[model samples]
Target chain A: MNALALGLRRARFETAVYFRQGDTVFFTFLFPVVMLTIFSVAFSSAGNFGTKPDGSGGITAAAFYLPGMIAAGILLSGVQNLAVDIAVERGDGTLKRLAGTPLPVLSYFVGKFLQVLATSALQIVLLLLVARIAFQVALPADASKWLTFVWVYLLGITTSAVLGIALSRVPRTGKSATAVIVPMVLVLQFISGVYLSFSQLPSWLQSFASVFPLKWLAQGMRSVFLPSTFETLEPGGSWDAAGTAAVLGVWLVVGVVAARLTFRWIRKDS
Target chain B: MSETEHVSVRDLRKTYGAFDAVDGISFDIGRGETFALLGPNGAGKSTTIEILEGYRDRTSGDVTVLGQDPGRAGRDWRGRIGMVLQSSGESGNVGVRELIAHFATFYPNPRDVDETIAAVGLTEKAGTRIRALSGGQRRRVDVALGVIGRPELLFLDEPTTGFDPEARHEFWSLIRLLKREGTTILLTTHYLDEAAQLGDRAGVVVGGRLVALGPVDEIGGQDSRIPVVRWVDAAGQREQRTTEPTALVAELHRSTGGEVRSLEVIRPSLEDVYLDLVAKHDSTATPTGVLA
Candidate 1:
């Protein structure tokens, strides 16, 4: 009956519903594992593709791609999945029906946030497992480093989910939702170092990527996983935890405020 | 507010830019009574219900549902009221039981989920996914969700809008069952038959105002309206409208030598009265203030 109790109950129901959705499960959990396995095996023998200062390849291809793949996993659960689902619900009038209930509108968002967190956690763990055993990439054995990875991963997922919620309000129909989400996600992945290292990308692309939070989140996540000696490969050859947190914090605030402003309980045309 | 009055509204006004959706309408619904807000499309019926449901804020007015102002009422007030919205599209993955049970947790005292499902005639589909159900069955699920908490006041907004005849009858029975359990119902529907059958008293809303309000039989003051007498005569058929139907019948009998063939006295039905009221209201209503 209390707000907290109601929120928790709704969150449990929402998570159950999400898990039952076959496509959501595939994209959130199975798709990342499948992609990780295929990519790691296919590029096993080749070294990492980013260029060294001496015009030679740097790390192994699997090592360079591990972070990118992890970033992709975060994208699948946090942005693509949440955006599409929210859009479909809005289009179908489910959100309006929920709004009519005694349940607070905030409870619905809490449920969605928790669902994304759980799915993203499962996804990150699966990605790391495949990276460790199949790709033979070494994970951080230090407790402090693992703690940093958890914190950065949580912050990234939270920021991306809020951003997804904000973006979903723009698309009024399900078809338009897909159209908007596909291009937006592809553009972010390209510019955010999910597909290639920032240094290897064109100069303009690297500078453009600086405007978004994804690039910083991926870079911060990699800093936690890679060795201290590999700091030079980072954006500024340093682990900028404070900067990453600041950018993510700003994005989180903006995303929530925008969502609150734009979110429609009932379709305007309807 | 009195103990007998379940809902009360005074000077209720809702404006959209330069237009008024519901302009200064006032009414009250008594406890355990079936009250109908009858109107055609765009008649501000939905707007009034939304304001009562706390889904929208009125531009200006005093409105109360179950003795509390919906705009300022918190969760406890909401729990005491049930609302069946115009449409619902629950997620495809959740089964009926799962969804119902989940909603039940929001209330301090909720009916048994299985019993609620049975009450809505959805027991057979309890384990089925919401997406797999047909429109009518899904509507039953919506009703089940609405009443699972056993609300003291229930708002049904065009509850049978998409139902087939048989489904509508079944839903009517379900509503009657709720009434039997002493739940107050506030219904809005375009179907005059639904209003006539379910409502003890109906209010005709026009041009953002309450044009008429009374029992179904007396709506439009039709009982006092001039009664029309019809009969088959040598000139094909004859008709006359008069307040004194007994005198007219006696005069007709005297003219026909006490054997008037196919003589029939006709009184206006609720639909006829409703149409006449709306027509009269429209002609007199300000062009800008039409409720719909």
Candidate 2:
């Protein structure tokens, strides 16, 4: 009847399909949990979690990796998943059929965005649970800290998702989608401090990491979970909440604009 | 826009770079009528259909579907029409009923999902995943979604392109059911028999022009085309093309003392006339800009 109702129906269908696909569920939701568990068990063997350096507590491996894995999970789902799906749909002629239908194109995007949000939300929660129970990782204290995590996570994932939607036009066929999307995601993951420590890298590397939102998003999450004393390990020796929001905010705006310009319902060769 | 006319096009033209895809064509489809636009590949059939479906912009033309210009039509107008594109619609291992029900919400008034599935002969496959189905079965899914909206008008672009004879017959019946329910249909196909079977009226589009448009049986000057009479003569066998086969047969009957062996008369089939028209147009090809 209404666009919202129809869009919601489509979204539920999309999410159901997402869950049914084994690989997608494994990569988007389960992989991070598995990684967090492995890292937590490996690093906490010394049994010094929340009781090192500072008399209060020290950062554990799970605490360090939970944020990075969360960030990576978000990136994988929002960027790789969304973009690859779009490209594959294009190759399969799904988009062309959609263009012919009475359904508004905006409704289709709304469905996909909803799917992204649901999967990403599920991922963050699972990572949080595993980190807390298995590794004794710290949770955000005070309302402001929790508030910071919420906005940063939401904005950062959404920005990546929007960029994914825009970049779907780059690949001509479903087979080509991975070729187009994987390299960029791999570059972002390596340079954004998702796999390695930002402070341990050279100054040029840190500067390079700061240019992207994944770095800030992971840093923002670390700020929430880690004690204030651990801020010295960050790029500017402290959490830059304002900078994180501004950079991600710019990416969201630019992504929306690019999606408007780049989105295509029919491929040229077709 | 006449009340009886569901679609009206005046000099519909579409251009791609320097070439005219849909050069200059004009045709009308009455309300509740099944009109088949038959053409070969690259005959601009798809381009014309796309413009009518509101999926593409035309270079220049006057066209209307359901009394609305498709180029400027909105969701309200779209709600009144259904489309079965050349490509598959459903995706990702979804069951038949689930996919149909999802599409139904996009329309204001929709047919019951079960009824729609049954109408397309997919009742047994309701719970079957789309990807697991055969090509023809998947095509039924396409037809299922197209008619699920209970659209006033339906556009089917090569709907039975890859169908086997049996599946095509089944699809034809489905279309007939829709026609009985008073849904206007505009389908494009390369199969002459398919056009003759399903189309009440047929339009032959060649080089993007409506060369011949009339009832399927009478298309391509059917009445005027001469019939050939063949019979066993004193000289073994003879055949003659004539406007008056009856007279020739009568003479032969009398001369042979009513022993007209192997005598038969046959008029040109639709395929013959269509081939003739296409060949004629192909040889005398002119720039599309010049209206024929």
Interface RMSD of each: 3.4, 3.1
Off by over 4 Å in 2: A41-57, A264-270, B223-225, B231-238, B244-264, B284-292
Local accuracy of candidate 2 as per-residue lDDT tens digits, A111-147: 9999999988988888888888876777876999888
Worst 10 residues of 1 chain B by lDDT: B283-292
Per-residue CA lDDT of candidate 1, range A1-270, in tens? 666667777778877788787866885557767766776677766656555678664555566667776777777777887788899888776887776667887777877888888888877788888777777777778999878877778888888898888888777686678777867877887788876667678777877887788888878777876666667766677878887889888998998898888877543321
lDDT measured at residue A258 in model 2 versus the true structure, 0 to 100: 95
Please give the CA lDDT of all the candidate structures. Answer: 0.80, 0.82
Error of 1 at A166 (Å): 2.9
Q: Which pairs clash (backbone N, Cα, C closer than 3 Å) in model 2?
A: none
Instruction: For candidate 1, give the lDDT.
Output: 0.80
When just chain B is superposed on the true chain B, each candidate scores a TM-score of 0.87, 0.88
For each candidate in turn, the TM-score is 0.89, 0.91
